[model samples]
Target: MEFPPLPLFTEVELKSEIARVATFKKVPKGETLIRQGQYLKVLPIVVSGAIRVFQTFEDREILLYYVRANETCIMSLTACLFNNESASYAITDAPTQVLYIPSDYITDWQTRYPSWNKFILAAYRNRYDELLHEFTDAVFKKMDERVLDYLRNYRDTHSVHTIPISHQALALELGTTRVVISRILKSFELEGLIGLHRGSITLKKPF
Candidate 1:
């Protein structure tokens, strides 16, 4: 498949390596592209939009990070590099376009293409920084403060005052129990900061 001009690829690589294995795909919003324990066969590079990367622990889930346009998922890269099953799930947060490369070509491409190696290293470093922030939030932030920040960030990014998410989903994203989330949301409602709906939360006032 033909790809748009990628940032770091030689003319030789474009002609010789990419054409042999890369495939282009259009993914719709809310689609699950990768599931935990799934076999690693393809590596996806986002050309547009967001992919939510998270891990499921039994009955609950915790968001790990997001893979946006021009970025790759470190968990997927690790799975492909180590030749193991996927350890986390990836879902499209919005309709997206992506370039898919067969995992078989990863080793050779990295070895033969310095630009590809640089891209992979840069992606890893970026994810490491995000993980560091996540650790800091978990260790130092209070639950209510973190939840408020999460809602504010979510609203700002989606450009909507109403967040269409369930308390269960919010709990999973925040790494807390649903009951706890419900209690906190109720508290927010009582404080007139937000209003709770059947499956969503509407911001009533700034936090």
Candidate 2:
């Protein structure tokens, strides 16, 4: 079995153990990795591509964060640590390859492997900062500003000016209605900020 180049797994013993037990998978875009209220049996680490973590309340879903290459979800780590059901679901944001380590191994490796402990602590810190930023933005920023920031950040992350997403999908991520997102996007188009194409939005030249 081939393993992705992960810095944390550089130790010979840990790498060998991971290779012996951990399972690897290539997940297609939009596929569900974890579901809310489900007990996690494995902790997923992204090898390539991205996973979008979100929470659903009633009919709406709010984006929590994205787990990119070489990263693991802190929520998943917490679930593994406490042996609790997941509060949010995760879905592949793009075609993704992931390494899934069994929950039992997670706690066992913490004291056994120094690198593993360091990785877990770093993941926790990074995710906490992200969650704080998300809360701050939701509380202080206007919806339009949030939308624009999302677009710019997405463009920068993906290195694509044309974002292939529907207004409804965008609204779900921003915790708003499709109509509101459409209205805001339309206003952006009118202001020469973006170009609205069929099922996609393209950032303008100066953007």
Candidate 3:
């Protein structure tokens, strides 16, 4: 099947540029799309399924966020666009398919194709908008509200109300300590607001 068209490239554009692009399928669960601390050589667009962006601490891996179908994953675009080394990881959390465009393709497009250059600008603009939203939310929203927002945005639809995330993972994402998270989660459990398990938390109601 033809990949669904994203605003980055229209049908005509993709058809004309097919020779420079490639597609890859990735199986679910624990697949690393791009390793941490390595150079990012390709810009990837999710064709299907989902992927998680994360970073590893001394014995823990903290999830930053996820990218679903139709979204693009370029965590360190500033560095990648400048051909600098990458400092973050992009890994697939679900079975996924992606369209990969080589790094040089961007330079070639900027020099040879103005239309494609506009598309690249649009892509960067979208990423910038997302980052701004996150920053604004972080500054203005309460911790509990931010946790709820994260749950709403990232929860698994197949089952469970709360997102499948560890306490430490949530702590790192929220920029807090695990002890603080544990206290909040315990209060949630006591209030019948949520249920906690070994690796996940389940929202009870109004989630």
Candidate 4:
């Protein structure tokens, strides 16, 4: 089913507005759209491909979340609206097509374009709710259970019974130590619940 261009505009208008937005750009795999600890100037919307958002402390970079096409990458509504610095890094997982929007342009569009305004506001709220859910899960769940839930959820979305996330990345995503993640994965492997290999794990059966 087709969604009306986020609510106030015709489909053609929405496409035209976005087209007039800013020049589209291509990013290669492993390149950063925005880096943590740096000042954010522009926010990017993913036109195609995927991006991984992460946070770094000293030498360790913790995985935060993933974004696919049609999702905003820079978290501008949060960082810019609150006048705070960015808290994560956004890096492409594959070669990506994106529209880079200037900060002032977004601010102006919010006043001039009703559909754009509504869409951006909704994206902000949805992302806020998602973070809240993640925080709740972290507070109430055990590490192993969280890991299991994460793997199951990831598998479902990726449409692959196997997941190729690295152990260290999984540790960061689950907010646990790598050793803890390793032990739990080993337990699951021993029970024939999954098959583990270099930098990947495959579910033996559906969750």
- C-alpha RMSD for every candidate: 2.7, 1.6, 3.2, 3.9
- Candidate 3, pairs of clashing residues: none
Q: Which one wins on lDDT?
A: 2
lDDT digits (tens) for residues 1-207 of candidate 2: 566666766688998899889999999999999999989989999999999999988867878889998899988888888989998899999999999999999878988999888888889898989889989998999999999999999999888999998999999888889999999999999999999988899999887
TM-score of 1: 0.84
In model 3, where do residues sit more than 4 Å from their true spots?
1-8, 55-65, 110-119, 156-162
TM-score leader: 2
- Model 2 lDDT at residue 146: 97
Candidate 1: tens digits of C-alpha lDDT, residues 1-207: 446657656557554667666888888999999999998888999988889998877766778888988888889988988889999999999888888888888777777778788788999899888889888999999988889989998888777899989999898888888898899999999999998999889997556
Could you tell me which residue pairs clash in candidate 4? none
Backbone clashes under 3 angstroms, per model:
0, 0, 0, 0
Q: By TM-score, is 2 or 3 better?
A: 2
Assess each prediction's global lDDT (C-alpha) against the native. Answer: 0.86, 0.91, 0.71, 0.75
Model 2 pairs whose backbones collide: none
- Per-candidate TM-score against the hidden true structure: 0.84, 0.93, 0.78, 0.83
Candidates by TM-score, descending order: 2, 1, 4, 3
lDDT of 4 by residue, 62-147 (tens): 77677777778545446755556888888887787777666666777778777677768777776788889889988998887888
